[model samples]
Target: MPTLDPTQLETLVVIAEEGTFDAAARRLHITPSAVSQRIRALERAAGQVLVRRTTPCTPTEAGEPLIRQGRQLRLLLAEAAATLKTGDTDDTVVDLSVVVNADTLATWFRPVLDEVATWDRTALRITVEDQGYSADALRRGEVLAAVTSEPKPVQGCTVEPLGRLRYTPGATPALVERYRKGRGIDWSAMPMIVYNEKDHLQDEVLAAHRATRPPVVHRVPSSHDFHEAIRRGLGWGMLLDAQAEADLASRTTIPLPGAKPIDIQLFWQRWRLDSIALDDLSEAVRRAARSGLRPTRPL
Candidate 1:
């Protein structure tokens, strides 16, 4: 079995996260050439090609697994070091890594920091991912907890039911009139805004009705920008109800037929170990979810 090289994995993780050799080198406080050489050496040591040296570099399949593990390893090491330091008189803080979706991050997620003002001794390190993808980070052990759309538990992680976040298909009245023209959804011909290629809600809505995929797909990556784009009549998109409610009430927005509601159930998945920081965060998140989310039937 090959022994893991912490330095090499660490370098790869940094490069993947930062997306540039020079940026990663600066982050590591090393020269660009040294960074490049180290990465090359790491690829050799692992006996696998890792990062692709392209613009806004991307990791190969082999690279992703190790890079994720590297982040988790660093977090665990930090926790262990903190535990050891706590034996001394010096004050120590535990570093906890967490994953969360961007929309929830933009919505009810950040309040946990202020909500847990009591836990001054601990510091949380967060990694933001999409709700649809955050669960993968939990499976990889890249984070202790995640705000995810998946209710299923990852191996060795305990699952806790949070609540549902509802998204609705909404569009501005002017945009609706122009596009619909007193008509209805046309799968192939309509222009639609989507949350990148990974987002399939719009396509799913059309397909469920046996419609063809829209030829003109406008990609808006940010949740905020996506809402703005739809409101501006640029395209139709699935907007969170909380985001579009005001517009809907003011007659600024309209929901498309056959696309009344799209609900995304979110869950809390975390390590089974008893950690004060984790417990506190979980409680706050659950409370927020219950307050805002639609009451769910057992799932």
Candidate 2:
């Protein structure tokens, strides 16, 4: 078994985060040559290339476990130092990286922000990803936690149901009427909107109706922008129940007649670590989900 040096592992993690050897050197307060030497020594010890020398350096597949290990080590050390120096005015800031779906960010997840805002010496780094794919960020060690649709836990992580986010297929009243064919809306001819290529809610609705996506598909990636696009009559799209209800009440949007609501069961997946910061965040997340999302049930 190869023995990994703590300093070299930390340097490799820093390089991956900083995206360049020079940047890592600056961050570590060492010379770029020193950074290169450490990386070389580490790679030699491991007998594999740990990082890809790209525009922004990325850990190779073989390096992911080490990267995760480095981050976990750093977090534990920070926590231990903070514990040992209790009330000594040594404010140790811990970075909490989490990946969340855009819809959750715009909706129920707002409360988590309020909770995190009150914490001392904590920095929140949120990566917006689609729910279906957010777990991939966890697998790549890009985030410490994720709001995902995957029920299975990623390796080294634990999964808990966060409840379901219900979506209604809706469109502007005018857009709905424009595509109406006799007593029914033309599912095949109506224009559609999607948050991104990863978003499948609209497609799922179409499939349920035995219809294919129309040619005039509009991509509005931002959650707020996607909602606004629907409000502006750009196209029909699946919207969160809260968003749909408000729009429907205001006569701005209407649910497609006979369209069944889609409920996506969400889960909270986090690294299995004994970090206080992570525990605080998980509690906040669970609380917010309970308040905003429907109760978890078989999907």
Candidate with top TM-score is 2
**What TM-score would every model get versus the actual structure?**
0.73, 0.95
Candidate 1 local lDDT, 13-80, one digit each (tens): 88877889999999999988988888888788778888998988878877867776676666556556
Reference-based TM-score, model 1: 0.73
- Cα RMSD to the true fold for all candidates: 4.6, 1.7
Report the CA-based lDDT of candidate 1 relative to the real structure: 0.76
Q: Write the per-residue lDDT of candidate 2 for residues 152-266, one digit (tens) a residue.
A: 9999999999999998889988898899988878899999999988988888888988999898999998888898999999999987886667788887888888798899999
Query: How does model 2 score by TM-score?
Result: 0.95
Q: Give me the candidate number with maximum lDDT.
A: 2
Per model, how many backbone clashes are there? 0, 0
